[model samples]
Target: MAAFSPELTVIYATIRTLDDQHPQATAVLVGGGRVLAVGSREEMAALAPRAHVLDHRDLILTPGLAEAHIHLVAYGFSLAELNLHGARSVSEVQARVAQRTMNTPPGTWLRGGGFLLSELGLDEYPAAAVLDEVSPHHPVLLFSRDLHLGWANSLALRLAGIRPDTPDPVGGRIVRPLGTLLESASELVTRVMPVPSEADFLAAAKAGVEDLAGRGYVSAHTMAFEEPEAPRALQTLAARGDLPLRIWACLPHERLEQARELGLACSPGSLFQWGGVKFFADGALGSRTAWLHGPGFAGGSGTGMPLDSPDLIRERGAEALRLGLTPVTHAIGDRANTEVLEVYEALRPLADEKGIRLRIEHAQHLRPEDIPRFRGLTASVQPIHLQADGPMIRELLPHRVDTSYAFRSLKAAGAVLAFGSDAPVAPPEYRANFAAALTRRDDEGQPIAPAEALTEEEILWAHTRGPALAAGWEDEGIIRPGARAAFTLWDRIGGNARALVL
Candidate 1:
């Protein structure tokens, strides 16, 4: 039978189809937003006689990029918040906060993230007094780069009812003297802070999607770490056909019951859709809260904080699977990985039965034995984080750096490696991801473990095919018949990439 008519033929010099049937295709015939034929320019042109032809004989074409994990709308809002991404000292943070305070009213909530304690050159948490001196009037809540920790000024702390005497919530810590909050403790302040209005969420989501598209991402698995309004904003944009990229969103496990009450499950849509339910298995490495198998962080006292317990994950994971949503867990530390793996092991049969893949977000650190447990599961990781976390990983968990960010090993063990930037933690820059994975180097120029580095092709597959599988999107991240015609044009592999959606 003849391919669909009124097609749009995309001609390129080199096209990496990511399809084994025809690994290389110079042209793709697209109709009705689906790829109708993948072959040579002549073949495609012949297949669609009167089709619109776009010629790019020099650029390389590949499947559209997928951000495996990101806080889509939050990152958008952060674009307007104080960006402390590169501040090297406490004074720098104070200076940024002070400036924002000077510009705004005293009582306004000042929120921002993307600072690291290590970046501040601190052995201990900085006191809130410094921030008080800068902006005593403003309520300030800044988050550590990993978003696992929060740094709140005294005004902000007092507003949240946190005092030196306040007991830490389970799975979270109020760093005493009231300077920082870890894990769920940050929620005390965050919950009390003003929620973003619907308009704000919509604006943020639009900005975030446009930003991702500008960076060449055609789709993202927006790991819903934000409020309900966040995804609603994306849904609104999708409904209006204003969304620039495809979105597969996760619901926080806390809201799983709400989703069930609404009878919501994995409903597929063209632009934005809900796909999985996300749970945090533990905290993050930057905050030293990633539930570890101690003797933990070298000279530290604690192993790490475990967030949602394994039993909780087991229960909700089954519910998510039954509801046709993937059970995605953020397992950072070795212990977290182990516990989540145990939970996944139990849910595997159910996931198989439901034809859904269980996913592990940020499978950052792992034990060698547990690596194989990821077999047939999606290892959703941000390799770009390695550039900054490499030195920290070496200093804190030297014993596990080899297996940390183990993309190759995960893939070798039958795990699908979905690569992302985890923006707001790190920007969604594919070049950063390419460098981090290909070199396995820290920002300090030290190689974490060169042997763990991946090849160019491996990186491409991880960023493309792996994320597609994780989101249960087969038409994306590949160029083949019946696949989405969405694609990315790269100057070269591991170089600049731009979305080329028709």
Candidate 2:
């Protein structure tokens, strides 16, 4: 039975239905927040005589845009915090930190992120003394662009009780000079930061969603990498009917035991829901922490550090699947991808039985031999990284550049290619995502894998349909019966777009 809307609404736009049978429509009649009828304006008007018609015939309409991956609340806090995403030198970083310090009260913790070692022109990790000169009184913690590594001033390090004699924790590293922390090591320091009040978290989430909405995103996949309080903030907003974006959240695999204890199930809510149990297989490319094969980084170090052990991933992945949630692992290097594939292969039968797809968060680099292993899994990638990592990929892992950011290769192998910006690292701007995926070119105008560049239609589908598949959202990413009426109207297929929800 068709669900009649409490209010009949008709939207007249240049509709690209994204549906095979009827690929295009002149207008769409939406009611009850779901697409009712998509057809010619005259036909839809005749079907709904008393419908409220919204005319936007000049713009192009498609499914609501989904960001697919981000640390929502964290991204929000970043908006007001320092931004070092494009700082070209250590001195520049110091200058910015110093400037911020002058404005901030002494002894207060100073936090900021988004710097590339390569961009800073440094081949080695920096030391605390560098930050000491400017931030003598205040404790400081700054993150590398990839967010896998952190640089802390002496005060912050002392606050975390990380002394020179302190041994490195399992699955993490402390740099020789005692200023930098990598992978899990950074977490030890971050855990010391004062916990925000529920109101604080709620405000951050609101800022994050409103920012994305301003960028034309109607929904997002808030990857779980923040404090547990973060998701709670989102849930609170949803419970109060204040969330502006639809959220599909993930749980850190470490919390699976706690989640199971609470009898948490994969049930939908009004605007927020739990989806994937997230795990990090390795660190990121820029941080040089990505687990790679032999001949690691041309002139650099080890076959990047592995984070979550395969044993842990397999055990927790099984638990996540058993709970009817997706097992999402992050893999950025060839070896990382290879290891994750082995784990997924072992869990295939279980996932199949549960009717849930396994997912890999950052299948960035791959061995030609392992490309086909991605079949039947979601390749959740951030194309925006390629813009910055392009030159680095060429310089660090030249041998793999041909296959790096292998979008088309993954798709041809039957892997779902869901696109995102990995925001707080890169801004969640669709234009950047579109440009990077369509051109496969770096900032230097060098094509990383031109052959892997996708068409406008393919990119749109990845940004829309591919994400829907990742989240198991059957009634989104399309304009058809039972699909959400949320739509994004574009000036051109790859041009500026805005969300229009009925």
Evaluate model 1: give its lDDT.
0.88
Residue pairs clashing in model 2 are none
- For 1-502, candidate 2 gives per-residue lDDT tens digits of 3433437888888888778888999988887788888889888867877788788888899999999889999999899888998899999999999999999999988999999999999989999989999999999999987899999999999999999988999989999889999988998888898878888998999899989987788889999988898999999889888887889999998899999999886886468999889999999988889999999988857789998999999999999999999999989999999999999999999999998989998799999989999999999999999999998999999999988999999999999989898889888988888999999988888899899999989999999989988888888898988898888988898788888877
Clashes per prediction? 0, 0
- List the candidates' TM-scores in order: 0.98, 0.98
lDDT top scorer: 2
Off by over 4 Å in 2: 1-6
Q: Write the per-residue lDDT of candidate 1 for residues 1-502, one digit (tens) a residue.
A: 5744563655555999999888998888887788888899888767777888788778899999889999999999989999999899888988888888878986999998898888889878777887889988888899988999898889999999998999999878888777888888899999889987889889999899999999898999999889889999898998898988989999999998999999998887568888999899888988988889979998865788888889999999999998999998999999999999999999999999999989999999999999988999999999889988977888889999789998888888899999988888889898998898998888899988688889998899988988998888888889998888789998999788889887
Q: Candidate 2, TM-score vs. the true structure? A: 0.98
Global lDDT for candidate 2?
0.90
> What is the Cα-based TM-score of model 1?
0.98
